[model samples]
Target: MNQVTRYSPLDDLFRGFFVKPMDFPSGMPAQQIKVDVKEQPDAYLVHAELPGAKKEDIHVEIEGNQVSIRSEVKQERDVKEGERLLRSERYFGQVSRAFQLPYELDEGQSSASFKDGVLELKLAKKLAQPASKRLDIA
Candidate 1:
């Protein structure tokens, strides 16, 4: 069998910092990444780890078989006395992730929840009646 390698642009994304080490497999102020996908007979569950993200910052949308997850955050510190600016390496921008759902999911029956820096989404796959058919052998 031939080797197959699927590519995703966000696969190597870092939350806090974008730049990766040139020599070592390391990055500064590392970003959090925890994704779990579970499929049942009638539904699908998706869980994503998003730390330091607010409800207003997250935006979810589903179109056809594609589900898009996008979030944006901006942090600024005002100049203050006795406090000098130091080297900063944390991220202050937007990040997004998209996935292609396997089955057709209902838009109304799906829901999402966030707690402890985790985002959980429940998607219900629509049920279609199976058609009767006979297999043919050659």
Candidate 2:
């Protein structure tokens, strides 16, 4: 005997309830901050692409071996005299990405630069040191 399964639309909707829906203009997907990490002998080099984002709006943070990057993009239009606005569109978005490396980073030595929509991070590795010390009885 063969068992039959029933088809339900509600089941499909509920199955992907937690997943975000993909919507883009003209079938083109939204752009994100693309990142590439290269591990060196004593440092890590990271290159991230943030299009249409200003350098002042980008931020980077490091915690232990984890690295987080956040950027905001905003677009505006200004109309001059004798120019009637037809359809105006303004876009504002925020994108963030976080990842972990094999070694911790030295915040004091690390440096970051942004140029031509590309962000470069030179992360220096933190030297390992003994964390525990001998305790004396009071």
Candidate 3:
């Protein structure tokens, strides 16, 4: 006799679930996210691809020791009782990313903007601290 373990319904619902209708402003998740980092001697420019995403729908935040990027995509969906949905495939939800840098950066100088479905981020590197001279006690 073989017995199948009962799994959580939560797992099964995901199998064929389309974008669930939600009141959330941004109805879509990170549809397609791509990040490009340009390393320079003085700074690092990070660019992210947010296709079908809007500037107002995205938010960027930085903490003392962390940098976080988040955004949402929105869409519309309709349903009719017992109606067959021909086809649909669109991801909707909040997307986030974070990264750490070796050198300190000037948070005040950070800037972000969206252009042609791409997010451009400009970060200015904090100036290196001068080495402190050590004096031996006489």
Candidate 4:
């Protein structure tokens, strides 16, 4: 079955006026860690977007088929001698995203890297092993 929908201009104009905004008191919108995952034959590739985050502040964890990413973005407090502060629009807080994959990940073989405000992960898939082996009589 197919359904048709109609677009209204008025709905777009007042979309968020009725609902509460996610912005903070400083007028900065809440930041979220965005991620993209790709599946290969033997591994899963992940690319996470974490702007203004230091490499040391980002953490990734894998448990079986579950994967989680976390990062902390701290607001810099540097001001030049002759510069006056006007306004700031950057977000400062922790953001995290977690998800589950189809196959279990091999934590020993998985790797991660961060560059240009982007986090890349190469998660290797765990190979299936036999549950039990026959034992010979002593």
Query: Any runs in candidate 4 off by more than 4 Å, and if so which?
Result: 1-27, 81-84, 131-138
Give the winner by TM-score: 2 or 3.
2
Q: What is the Å distance of residue 49 in model 3 from its true position?
A: 0.9
Model 2 lDDT, full chain set: 0.88
Query: lDDT-based ranking, best first?
Result: 4, 2, 1, 3
What does candidate 1's lDDT look like per residue over 1-138, in tens digits? Answer: 999999886775654365753454346654544678899788889998877688778888987667888877565767789987655555667767888888877888889998887889898887775988889999
- Clash statistics: count for each candidate: 0, 0, 6, 0
1-138 per-residue lDDT for model 3 (tens digits): 999998998988786566665444544343557788887887778899877678899887766435677888776688889998765666667777887776777788778778998888877787877899999999
Locate the minimum summed-lDDT window of 10 residues in model 3: 21-30
Q: Which residue pairs collide in model 3, if any?
A: 27-74, 28-73, 28-92, 28-93, 29-92, 29-93
In candidate 1, which residue pairs clash? none
Q: What lDDT does candidate 1 reach at residue 38?
A: 95
Which candidate leads in lDDT?
A: 4
- TM-score of candidate 2 versus the correct structure, residues matched by position: 0.65
**Root-mean-square deviation of candidate 4:** 12.1
TM-score of each: 0.64, 0.65, 0.63, 0.71
Identify the superior model by TM-score, candidate 3 or candidate 4. Answer: 4
TM-score of model 1 (CA atoms):
0.64
Q: Give residue 49's lDDT in candidate 4 (0 to 100).
A: 97
* lDDT, model 2, position 79: 83
lDDT computed for candidate 1: 0.77
